[model samples]
Target: MLKKAIGGSLAAMLLAGMVLGTDALSYVTTACGNVREAVKSEITPEFELDRIRNEIDKLMPEIRQHMTVVAEQSVDVKDLQREIAKKDTKLASQRDAILALRADLSSSKDSFTYRHVSYSRGEVEADLANRFESFRNGEEALARDRQILAAQKQTLRANQKKLDSMLGRKQELAVHVSQLEARLKTIQASEAVNAIEVDDTKLSRVEGMIKDLNHALDVRESILETEGNVLGRIPVEEDSVDLHADVVSEVDQHFGLTADENVAEAAQSDSL
Candidate 1:
């Protein structure tokens, strides 16, 4: 279908160009190239590979048929060889018999004997002439057959080589296709790997929230410590004041201690 479309497009372009005049011919090459590129672009690698594989498969039957023909030809060549060998043996015997008959005739023999049957010189001569004629014809026929056999063998060798070449090419194509498939798989896998993505936006927001909460907690703890330190201190007066003597005497009287008794005891002790 694509081939037909391309062909149609090319025809239309050619027709249009013809209508436009010789000046349009300059653009034909460029237009054809563009069309070819467009066709190539539409053909995917996988589809092309499949097409190649199918073509390879389609060749198999023809190859097998050729193989069958070659095999049959091989058998025919062998059979012809055997036939030629038999003919060669028969010709050798006939040649020896002809030579023997000529020798007999050369001796001026008036009669010849064959299996106890007798023949005059004339009869032997006639038989020799006929045998010679038959031998010549047989030799010619054998030569022709030999030529045909040689040609057939040559053709078979060439064909066998062709088959071998085809088989080798098919193997190479199969291996190449496998390699292409594996490479394509690797590329697709890489693309899949490349396609993977991680969205860290929400994760980053959550992390920010956690950090803010930590900071707030730390600030609150710092504020509490500061307030406790400020409020837990003992209030003290900076100025030093002398205690009132009356207050001291009343404090001493409350504890039942007399300052005059203590002073009298201390004076008596000092005099002793």
Candidate 2:
């Protein structure tokens, strides 16, 4: 109902715009274009394919009608051709009879005999004149019939060609529709395969939390080693000895003094 109302409103606006001015009409056209695009967005490929199939189905009845018409026309053309052939044979016989009578009259005969009946020259001439007139009229009628047959044959050929073209186009459209449906299915399948549900925000938070935990653990380990002073520095014997305390001991050893405290006093007394 809402969609219908919106459509009605759009149509009313378009009519009003068209009645107003070209600029308003242009605006209405743009609005309709936007609506058209919106409608197109909602229409799926499957729906369009179904519509195409329905349209193709509709054409079947019309094509069948055309086929029927062409078939009837073909029958009619064949009948006409047979009729023309029979007339042509009859006309040929009539023409030969006329030519024979003319040939007999040209010989200056006073009378003529035909089928064991003798007729005077006047009777023969009158009979020949009537026969020739009849033949002429028949030839004219046959000529007209031949023309009609030719035209009918041409019409039948055209109708047959049109029918063939329609059938061919129908087949092509069916194949094209099938191809489109197959391609649409392949694309849908690919999209379904490629679509993965993953939350980027959650994944990023997890990575950040792991990094922060590692940093905190490293800082705590460093603090513990510094406070305990256990294996904090390299173990060496040189670090254990005090350099200031060793200086007097090194001097006493070099001088070979037995009493380090009395050496200086004894040297002073000896000097005195």
- TM per candidate: 0.59, 0.59
Q: For residues 82-111, what per-residue lDDT tens digits would candidate 2 score against the true structure? A: 888898898899889889888998988899
Question: Tens-digit lDDT track for model 1 on 67-171?
Answer: 999999999999999999999999999999899899999987799898899999999899999999999999998999999999999999999999999899989
TM-score of candidate 1 relative to the true fold? 0.59
Model 2, C-alpha of 81: deviation from truth (Å): 1.0
Local distance difference test, each candidate: 0.90, 0.88
Among residues 3 or more apart in sequence or in different chains, the pairs in candidate 1 whose N, CA or C atoms overlap within 3 Å are none
Candidate 2 wrong stretches, greater than 4 Å: 1-33, 195-272
**Model 2 lDDT on a 0 to 1 scale:** 0.88
